[model samples]
Target: MDDLDRKLNDAFPGYVVRKDLVKQVRGNAAVPSYVLEFLLGQNCATDDEEQIKLGIERVKDILAKHYVQRAEAGAIRSDIKQTGFQRVIDKVSVVLNEKRDAYEATFENLGISRVLVDSDTVKNNRRLLVSGVWCIADLSYSANEAKDESPYLLQKLKPIQMSRFDFEGYAEKRGNFTMDEWIDVLIRSIGLDPSQMGKRAKLFQLTRLVTYCERNYNLIELGPKGTGKSHVYSEFSPHGILISGGEVTPAKLFVNNSTGRIGLVGYWDCVAFDEFAGKNKRPKADIVDIMKNYMANKSFSRGIEQVTAEASMVFVGNTSHDIAYMINFSDLFEDLPTVYHDPAFIDRLHAYIPGWEMDIIRGDMFSSDFGFIVDYLAEALRHTRALDYSELYRDHFELSDTLSTRDKDGIQKTFSGLMKIIFPNKEVTTEEIAEILEFCLEMRKRVKDSLYRIDETFSRVQFAYRPVDGGSWVNVETLEEIDFPGTYHARDLVPLEGESVDEAVIEVAEDHSGTTVQEVSAERVSVPAIEEKTLFEGHKAYRENQRGVSFDGLFGDYLKGARRIEIIDPYIRSFHQCRNLMELLEVALRYFDYKAPSLEVHLVTGPDDYDVAKQRDYLDQIANAMAPLGLDFTYEIDMSGIIHARHLKIDDSWDILLDRGLDIFQKFDSGNAFAIENRMPEMRRVRQFEVTYLKKD
Candidate 1:
């Protein structure tokens, strides 16, 4: 086990299970991850290898014997009949059989119906009465020929979820881990490794959980498929239910008009609608009206009575068009059905997650690390919904007065949920609060901006905020707004061939192979020759996975005509970091004269704490490669241990502060030489970063 694994075990023993263990025992079993993790949490929650092995075998044995498969349902029923009684794992849903004056339990996979269930069982497991819940139930069969009675009988029933959790203890122990550690813990808890995601991308995943941790928060995500949009709601928690968007009915989601019974909103902490973005979907008018009321007022009309519930709503679907096309020709909510495209319904949404920023699911992204058995994490998040951390940013920042009450509510709910998940203890720094506040504003602004494009009556309002401590008001813009400025906001409305909406010029190429050409972004084009280009002084932000960006265009003018350059970035120790430095040097080479007497570039960086020898060797390689090119490259271990500032100093005048330094690009197919991203830097996407050009006074 690594340091994090050891720390997790030491901090909260018997609550966490190795994430990879889920796959080992989940062979062809059509069960949610929480159901499997519940079993694993009971058996293999310890670090002992021998105990884990035994527990794995025991769990596998239990599944093999008890878990029901539709294909083997008949054989299992025969076995139950022969044995007279058997315990099986399957989804169990119950409905009150009014005529019989008893609740009837139906085994979803066992394919049995009309089994008697006591009222107390239905009351204790109310969620099962709403949606089918995975449960381990004892069943018995006694061949009967009666018309109203069946031989199949339900004995003891147990819902496969965390029965009890100590929220106080969980919150107290949460203080033991730093913000970064806790974020990574949540990332791992969701089955993805934190090392594979960036700060922005990690937040993107965490935002999906806000619905679980906040009341009445409505969020939607629409992008290309395979980004795990529905995974969290379906697998990570028992408190959330993921149903098909088309499958939902007003009776199922809100209330049954025939029977005075409540639905999913009354039972689950979060109700996520999967495959929600279809242009042709025909949702019922009553459901849409009920949804708008519930999403906005958190209450729906039920036969002259108003019903209220705390369940947050989440909508996940796939987009047919890319971000640029949607932003230019239509709104971000382009994929929604015509009925749901109502401005009133769209305005009720709190946030629109930029799903395009998330990388598609990859094998290496799955974590094998120790994390909460998900059910435990789910309970903790559910408990946090009762607490409000929205005012945490009031001491440091304030929202724009232009924002409506709905806007404020959306922003506050999102901020509060993120705080509960990240800082459950309610302890945070000002910088941390600012980051969350700005992110909240940007998210809400994304939704509001689309409203302007969708509805002419929606007025444009300034989506900006300022620090209460007296800094300049900061303007917020969605990543798409910055990436496609000319075509976005309905400007220019068109792009001619061989030109770009952002600034990365496209080169025209011919298709000589007698086939259709494939168009790809060329972000990493070679550096242009030095010229009298104006070097602007300001800050710019880039989004993760946003293409058409490179060091050549970012700082080619700043590095031009410099006799001496000092790049002070503390984390240039890894192979990728070193390669990033070499690429930056390549950009500077095109700007500087090779025949110049002293083309000096010294990097102030930190040694790799894990492997300093390897770090030095990589640095040496850069020095050797640069020496032959007439650029004297040297690096020194800052040794200060606090070289947090990443910036480049040119001739003691120009200073370019880098938020992510030279390592701004996201991981890609570096080993695959033929990959377009490897051949063209412009084709590669970048991690969210900021760069500021400042002249030293």
Candidate 2:
């Protein structure tokens, strides 16, 4: 184990199970990951190889003898009859048999029913009434012709869940991990590799868990297929139920008036509808109306009375069109069913997760590292539903007064849910609180901004916030607006009269640290206008997956009219880093005039500790290649080790600070010669980073 893994093991101990072990034990069984992890958590929670091997064998033996497959159900029933009793692992759901005045159990996949269960068992494990529970059950059989009754009997049943979790212990142990480490652990627990995802992408994955923890939190995710949009709701928690969007009815979701029995909302903590988007799929209009009311008020009307439920709503679907197409030709909610296309229904959603930003699930994306046993995490989240951290941000920042009550509520719920997930102890720094607050505000802003385009009556609201300690308001915009300015600022979807939307013009000014800064008007009034050049060099931030960035756009104007340039980046040793330097040189050569004197460039970088000779050779090759282009290149190592800042000094006129130095592009297959990104720097996807332009006056 590496340092983080060892630290996680030391902190979480028995609760941390190797995520890959789930696949090793699940051969052909259709069991969900949580069930398999529960079994593994009991036996193989240690790092000892011998113990893990033994545990694997024991788990295999248990599955072979107990796990009931549908095809083998008949043989298992015969075995039970012959032996008079047998133990099996299957999904067990109980229903009240009014006629017999008893609760009867049904073993799904085992295809057995009418097995009598006691009232205490049903009451203790009430989840059995709605969806079901994976349990280890003992079945007995006895022929009774005189009584005219079936012989199937439920002798004993144990739901496959952690009987008890130490909530205090869990919260206390959270202090041992940094916020990033905890986020990584949570991502791994859900079977994803955190290393493969950006910070925003990881947060998006964790946002799906908010519904599991926050009461009545409504979320919708519509994206391309294979992003694992519905995986968490279906497999991560037992308190949640994932059902087909088309299969839902008012009776199953709200209440059955005939039987007067409460439905899924009464039993489950979260109800998610999979495959929920499609114009052709017909959903009951009445159900949509009731869902909107419940989502807003947390209560649904019953015959002569009103009943409240704490179940959060989730909708996951695949979008048939791309985000740009949807934004230009239609609204983001275009794919939803006609009944759910109402503005009121759309407004109730607290957050809209941009599914298209996620990468498709690849084989390497599954982590083999240690993570919390999902059952433990599930219960931990469920326990946090009662805790509220919505007001935590008020200590540091204040939301704009222009926001409506509904908008404020949506933002608060989202912020509260994220705080519960990341800072359940209610202990956070001001910077940490700001990060989450801005993310929450942006999510709700995405929903509200789209609403304005869809219905012009909905006036635009400034989604800005101010620091309580005193500072200018920090305006937040959806990353979509930054990346796709043309589509986001289309003239047809203009803002309301008397309201001005600030169009951020990103200009690369020559400065010490070439940072991009927005030029805001004194009245805070502007209009949305698309500019050809989007890259700025003064003082601005860029989100991950944002496009329209190139080397020329970032440094072209800054490097102009300069005879000498000094590149001071320490990470210019690796082959990829050298390639980035070479790309920058190419950009410089293209930017400078051939008629001008030779442009001199000097690199002040750290040498490779392991292979200095190879690094020198690469630099020499670059120098040699650029010699014919009227560019003089030379290098010097920083033996002082004090040159930590990554900035470029151009003839004492501008200082450009590069947060990621020259290594901004994400890793790609350089072996593929035909790849366009390999030849064109602008076509490559960049890592999340920031650049600052400081004037050297």
Candidate 3:
């Protein structure tokens, strides 16, 4: 085991399992992750190789013997008839037979129905009434004389869930890991690799967990498909139910007036609508109205009574167009159905996760590392719902005055939810508080900003915040706003400090904003204006997975007239790093005078420790490639290993500090020549980076 794996195993014994084991044991079982992990947690939650191997064998034996497969249902039923009783693991859902006055159970994969269930079992596992719960059940077939009683009997049943959770104990153990480590632990628990993500990206992933832990929280994520938007609600927890967007009805989600019975919202902690963005989808109008009231008030009218439920709501679906197209031609909510397109419904969303900012699901992104058993995590989250950290930030920061009560509430709920997930012990720093508050504020701001584009009647609340101790009001803008500032803010945007709102910005915005960003009902704000991209002499931060950033845009204005450039990046040995160096040269070539004698670009970098020869070869190739374009590229291997600082010095006048050197962009489809990001650097989502331009003495 690696150090982190060892640490996790030592700290959280019997609560975590090697995550990759799920795929190994799950050979087409068609079960949720929590179900599979439940079994694994009982058997393989250990670091010992011998015990894990034996556990895997035992679990495999159990599944082979007891796991019900629909295709083999007849064989299993025949076996039950012969043996008089059979133990099977299957999805069990229950319904009340009004005339018979008895609860009937259906084993989904076992292909058995009309099984008689006792009132005690039905009352104990009420979730079975709302959604199919994966459970181990003892079934016995019976040949009865009564036609209505030709039946199977349910002897016993156990739902696949963590029966007990200690929130205090879990919160206490959290201190063993740092904030970053804890975040990684949670990310791994969700089966994603934290090494491949940045702070912002990690936060985006954690926002998915907020819906589970925070009661009545509303979140929507609309982006391109295959980003795993529905994965969390579907597989991460047993307490959450993922339903098709079109399948929603007032009776299914809220309450049935006919029977006076509660629905999914009353039973499940989280109810998610998958594939929710198709404009053609005709969900019941009543569903939209019900959702509007429930999302806002956390209560819905049932006959003559008010029914309250704490179920969080999530809407996730494929966005038809890219962000640019949606921003220019329509708004981000373009794919939402006409019925749900109301401002009242949209306003209830506490946070709109920019799913486009999420990296697509890749096999490599799944971790083989240790993570908590999902059931444990789910139970912990379920227990944490009772705790409210919404006001935790009041001591550190305050919201903008322009924000409405709804906007502030959204921010508070989102912030509180994140705190519950990340800092369950309620231990946090002022900077950390500011960081999360800003993130949550921007989330709500994204919803608000898109609302403005759809309907200008929505007030332009400055989505900014200030530190309670004293600080300038820090403005929060969605990443889309940063990329497409002009149209993203459709109306005339307040200019940056000292810069006049000029016709030039408007012209640029109009020219660039034509072909991009979503939807249906509101009159879209079509005034496309660009915020000036003028460079400054201070630090500039760029988010990971955020597009519309390029080396040319960043360095063009600064590197325009330089004759000589000195790049000291110690870690330029890898192929991507070499590509970055090459791209920087191209940026310089785009603006520099190629007709000059030669633009000298020299680099001082360390040799690749693993493959020094390949490093030399790459550098030599870069030099050879640049020499022909009247750009003399040279390099020196700083064997002393002291050259760790990365900065660009041009013409001995400007020194630009690069936190990540020229390797700003994340790994992408460079192999696919057709990839637009390969041809246009601005189209690429960058790795989180910061640059500071300073005047050298």
Looking at model 1, residue 411 earns an lDDT score of 90
TM-score, every prediction: 0.88, 0.89, 0.91
lDDT of each: 0.86, 0.85, 0.86
Which regions of candidate 2 fall more than 4 Å away from where they truly are?
146-148, 245-247, 486-537, 560-564, 573-575, 595-602, 607-642, 667-685, 695-697
Expressed as tens digits, the lDDT of each residue in 525-620 for candidate 1 is 245578866668888877776788988888888877889999999999999888889899998899997567868999999878899999999999
* Candidate 1 ranges beyond 4 A from true positions: 467-471, 491-532, 537-548, 561-570, 594-659, 688-697
Model 2, span 97-150: residue lDDT tens = 887898888899889887789889988999888768999998899877745345
lDDT of 3 by residue, 202-229 (tens): 8988999998889999999999989999
**Residue-level error in angstroms, candidate 2, position 532:** 15
Output the better candidate (2/3) by lDDT: 3
lDDT of 1 at 358: 80
